[model samples]
Target: MVARRNWAGNVHYAARRFHEPTSVDELRRLVAGSDRLRAAGTGHSFNRFGDTTGDLVSLAGLPPDVTLDRDRSTVTVPAALRYGDLATALHAQGHALANLASLPHISVAGAVATGTHGSGVRNGNLASAVAALELVTADGDLLTLDRDADGDMFAGAVVSLGALGVVTRVTLDVAPAFTLCQYVRLGLAREALDEALDSAYSVSIFTDWRTPLLREVWVKQHAELPPPPAGWLGTTAAETPRHPVAGLSPEHCTPQLGPPGPWHERLPHFRLGFIPSSGDELQSEYHVPRAAGADALAALDEVAHLIAPVLQVCELRAVAADRLWLSPNHGRDSLAIHFTWVGDAAAVTPVVAAVEERLAPFSPRPHWGKVFGLAPAAVAAAWPRYADFLALMVRLDPSGTFRTDLLDRYFPRP
Candidate 1:
């Protein structure tokens, strides 16, 4: 919509019609006219979730309407609103989201549909925050999806992968905004991964995969009293083992706050405007069982030696269990190991293979946006709900207008 090209450079087949629709009727008209149609949000998804060669319908111009009911403690928002915008608005009303993914720039609707998450022991995927939704089905029918209305559709739409329909609005159960004491410290020797994780509201580790050591650990505590009003934030109650060595590569940095109370900025340590990343950087993340996190990290270490030197970064984090069928957590608490590299995937593809080979014992769920992947059959091993998810997709979008090569790869024709 904005100059045609998106942030990720997802190109269309041709210079097609770009429509910005505010109402469902306008979107329906746009979709009806085009042979192949797809709705796009802020275009934050890294892959082709919004990649349609036909008409591209953007909901950017849609007015943002958020109303909060303190008595019920829920806030309803326009699906097109970015989480960053949503968070700020929510904070103004003394409300906050339960959790937020690393980057706040993504649209809540887009992120929820893809199962976006943040590191936390008590939090679930963003979609799990939904209490209700205003959905526009392909046949131009409007429906409000809720847990009681249609259970399967409700579960599937959470990670619907933008398949079921265009989510126009979302109402979420919110919590009273609380301050977090962000503690960050090097964990050169902290091996208390699971136990330490259990103590904090959220945690993050920035480490080089090549080493057996946890380079650093970041813990966020529930602060009844504001954190030390000076100096850098400290790591949580997790014990950090002593570093026997002087220094590895001397590359360690801490997470910083953009501003307090606004949870969206806190989701990501670095903002696109504050600090720019490599123009050619690529990201791939996988979710493993929380119980298997330690073992998976050990297996990853075996290949870490191969990737350490060439790799940009390896991030370790956790996400709470959720009921959303396609959420990475699915029925189990999840630990995500993420990778960001500087160039073509080929340089890191072999390392990813080594990880997959070693991680066979603990089937890993790959993130939808990033590229490291397995076929549909492989995904079935990671998420048991594949069959149910596929079945719902067929019923909701039998014609496959929302289908793409990526969807087909993860979801073979039934």
Candidate 2:
């Protein structure tokens, strides 16, 4: 069998066989027959979170049953549906999600399962939008969990990291469609991030960490709100469109320079039709308390020299607190420090360690789907509800049918 690698060509799945079932019945049979199984979606993860030694399944072949409930203000979508497609469909019907990650090509189930997020001081991670979800557990029995009905368990299940079972469908809360405008500021000073984060609906600051000045600040503001000042924070607006990573062509990026557009178009940094970021790159992100944003920056600045050689670009964004058990921004408002590293794992691994060490004082929580070298013990200590999530995992799949090597290492079964 030809080896299947992840989007970044980083993790090659070790599944003995790969299956793509076209219907729910077919998927159920596949899951029931396999002693161990794991489901993959869009292959966007940088690590082995989706890998298994047993059979592997992909839900992409399942029918995208997008159902919208106007009264309830929710949309139940197939797990395999991409965010970009979902956003377009919602906008046509005068609805929209609260926010979107930088890249819209990711599967909704995959993104939410791993606690993926977009930037905004008041916005929660993608998983927080899950009002309900359907998953086929180890016994091939379909189970549905609702945010209001399930209470604490639902919070734990939304960000399961593929441990409980294969999420088949998700019901997400929606809002009235809105418009926003994108603007890019060049050469922003490092200390001005807090002010800038609150200046727009969503903001992303990008830098290479070699200097005190940030490379670019991309702001998405509500069209109804007043526009940002022309020369705010000693920064000048970019005359033309710009990419997050310096020197890369801006053709793949979303429109900039303050033209009003639908929320779907402006919220994400990259256009859905194009590959996001440097396609050949490795990513790592950490969430620290928003209160420590400045101190976290200072900590990393001490190791800037170590990060510069292997770094492509780094991003800083804010995320509001949530109740999700495993979400990085679980208890406190957060500042997500993201790293896009050169594809070379050998060169990047040590740098990542140095970064984790630097941010240790802030009790940083690593992004579940990204590459990180944090020890299992350190990871467990970071999340207040880690043990609760483990209990939920066992309750849903006691046989460990969905467990992978990565899951076993971080959440070892008793």
Q: Which candidate is the best by TM-score?
A: 2
Tens-place lDDT digits, model 2, residues 108-200: 999999999999999999999999999999888899999999998898999989899889999999999999999998899977989989888
Q: For candidate 2, what's the RMSD? A: 1.3
Colliding pairs, model 1: 183-234, 183-235, 184-234, 184-235, 189-241, 210-304
Highest lDDT, which number? 2
True lDDT of residue 172, candidate 2: 99
Q: After superposition, how far is residue 101 of candidate 2 from its true place, in Å?
A: 0.4
Work out the TM-score per prediction. 0.87, 0.98
Model 1: per-residue lDDT, tens digit, 1-414?
433655545333332677788777787666555566677776555566567666667787777677898997888888878776777788887888888776677787888888877788778878888888887776766779886677866877778878777788888889987766555555445466776567567777777765566766655666554542332232333233212112422112223431233354445443423323323556678899998888888777777777676567777788888878888888998898887765565676777677777777888888776656565567887777788888988887777767766677778669
